[model samples]
Target chain A: MAKNYTKISIETSNDLKPKDETIDFLLNYSKALSVLKSAKVEFELVLN
Target chain B: MQEELITDATLVSSYIKGNESALEILIKRHKQKIYSFIYSKVYDKDVAEDIFQDTFIKVIRTLKKGNYNEEGKFLPWVMRISHNLVIDFFRKNNRLPKFDNSGEFSIFSVLSDTSLNAENSIIKEQVEYDVRRLVDELPEDQKEVLLMRIYNDMSFKEISDKTGVSINTALGRMRYALINLRKIIDKHNIVLTN
Candidate 1:
């Protein structure tokens, strides 16, 4: 006789909350965008 | 002399042959995106600038040593080097993200007693759940690009190289991901922030 196996899987998204990692990423991304914008201006200035 | 028409590979080859201006033109051509990529990870202007300069220095050294092999994909190659350097910086500084598994670790846990009401906490938690679920609903390719762009701070070019797709395809996936996410948000009336 073949052995029987039972498998159970649980999916949980209800417990999700804003992670510090995501928050930090957003903050960093915003700052980086500003820095890049300023750098572009400075680069243009030097080129001119 | 149509200098602007020179390709990255040509500029790199010329630089390798001791034409210093070729390297300058190469740097000038790709510095903005490269700098932006670095800034996305470091988040500090001074630090990003330092890494940006260091990335070029390393690139120059590698090119001089005849180590850089990706001729046509010079920008993507350099961006990979920049990404590695950012990782190294984080490793050296011990600044990598950490997850606290303790039950007490939560956004609400940091709030004052007066502000830690159940209603507000539930709303915050729901918004986070909805946002994550929406992201999960995205197609695999789009989700991959979205996560890489957001979490890994990788540029589209880097995403393309990593995912083995054209840059345009990677960018298109990201665009579609955003559009789909927006549609989901609107359909669910998901409020992302208070």
Candidate 2:
């Protein structure tokens, strides 16, 4: 994470923001995405 | 501040190097633009949300595989992805009508307005049901953590207390649960959106 990271949210044309559910889902999914990538790196390290 | 000084290219590289929260900052910074782009194309909130999620999924996959080399052009690159996904949504629902080019005009495709109606909503429900069913296939501990966090809306500390584990352990289970769910989705080729 970058230092001094602040949560700056923006809304859409409908005058409504993206749902909290959607934002949470994306953040969680991104964390999971990085996990698999790191796991693969570990696997390759063991292979070599 | 510091975040504003950190460019998208820097965030992209941080995410590739396994800093997950960098991706979160990236998503939050541009979510409004991307979400609005999808919503403008689809004209439906649910459909726009689904496309937004799918766009990030594709972005994460590309970055994880070290295939994202667009230099500092992150916003445009992501906008192009979201645009393609909007097209995919239209293509999937046959919203974009195909005209008959064989001299005669075709009314069938025009009349085939298969937009989000009652029937489409039913299909969407079925897809959600199928996803929940797949969640059952995760390992016991991971499934428990996922159900508690997602379905029950419990915080990690609360989950840790209930599950008799450290907070870090609970978080790990949740992360592994999500990773396994993605693998299951891929193996079953389940398109989460209708």
Candidate 3:
């Protein structure tokens, strides 16, 4: 096995969850999710 | 995550049980955000609206019969539709619809005739333009994930599922996307309040 030497940066997982910003362009994305749920068309999953 | 699951499951289940009104409530609940998400990708109001209506229409058909299993993330599922509709829109015209290079979801929604009375308070117009420019500079993959995750407010897991990649890959893409955006902003000497 060839040994390689290089400095590597590593990260440990933490409880830092991303905060949802209200001002980002997607401020209204929740409502989009809602609209998809009540969409007006129906289809068969084409289950094969 | 728990809250989204609960709400998604509730709305989907209600629609499944022969309640048409439930679907209306669902549409009313999501119109702005979904419209915003679709418009972000398509960038034209008429085209976006058509694709949006088509997405929901497909959803309706998906639900009318005993098709949906009700065991999936509803938002992601619908997003899959929006994404597919976007592709169809492109393919139908024999051209791929690439998103605007700027990551900013167009601010046009905020600038309509009624903009003076809206309640959102955050970034100003200049910052929005800067953010959009930075987003536009991203590689397509990173840009797609960022749009889905940030603009669509999808979870990493959801983004991964929708994009057909592993969760770690999705996370990596988003991490790199932010890093690139920072570089772009600094390179351009743009300051965003975000």
| Maximum-DockQ candidate | 2
Interface-residue RMSD per candidate?
Answer: 15.2, 3.2, 12.0
Using TM-score as the measure, name the better of candidate 1 and candidate 3.
1
Clashing pairs in 1: none
Candidate 1 similarity to native, TM-score = 0.42
Best by lDDT: 2
**lDDT of candidate 1 at residue B66, scale 0 to 100:** 65
What residue runs in model 3 are displaced by over 4 Å at the alpha carbon?
Answer: A1-48, B1-6, B97-194
Write one digit per residue (lDDT tens) for candidate 2, span B69-166. 76549999999999998888888887765566554557774577767899789999999899799889999999999999999999999999999999
Stretches off by above 4 angstroms in model 2 are A1-16, A34-48, B97-194
Please state the i-RMS of candidate 3: 12.0
Work out the TM-score per prediction: 0.42, 0.49, 0.38
Across residues B1-194, which tens digit of lDDT does each residue of candidate 1 receive? 57789988988888777777777667666766776777767767667776776677677666765667963499888989899999988989766554554444555556547764888899889877877788899999899999999879999889999999999999999999999999988988877984
What is candidate 3's lDDT per residue for B40-127, written digit by digit as tens?
Answer: 6766767777777777767776666557867787777887888889888888875453345454454554545744333333456657
Candidate 1, after superposition: displacement of residue B157 in Å? 73
Q: What share of the reference contacts survives in each candidate?
A: 0.00, 0.43, 0.00
Model 3 lDDT tens row, A1-48: 999996342222221111223212122322233322237763333221
Clashing pairs in 2: none
User: Which 10 consecutive residues of model 2 chain B have the lowest summed lDDT?
Assistant: B96-105
Each candidate's chain B TM-score? Answer: 0.51, 0.49, 0.45
Better TM-score candidate (2, 3): 2
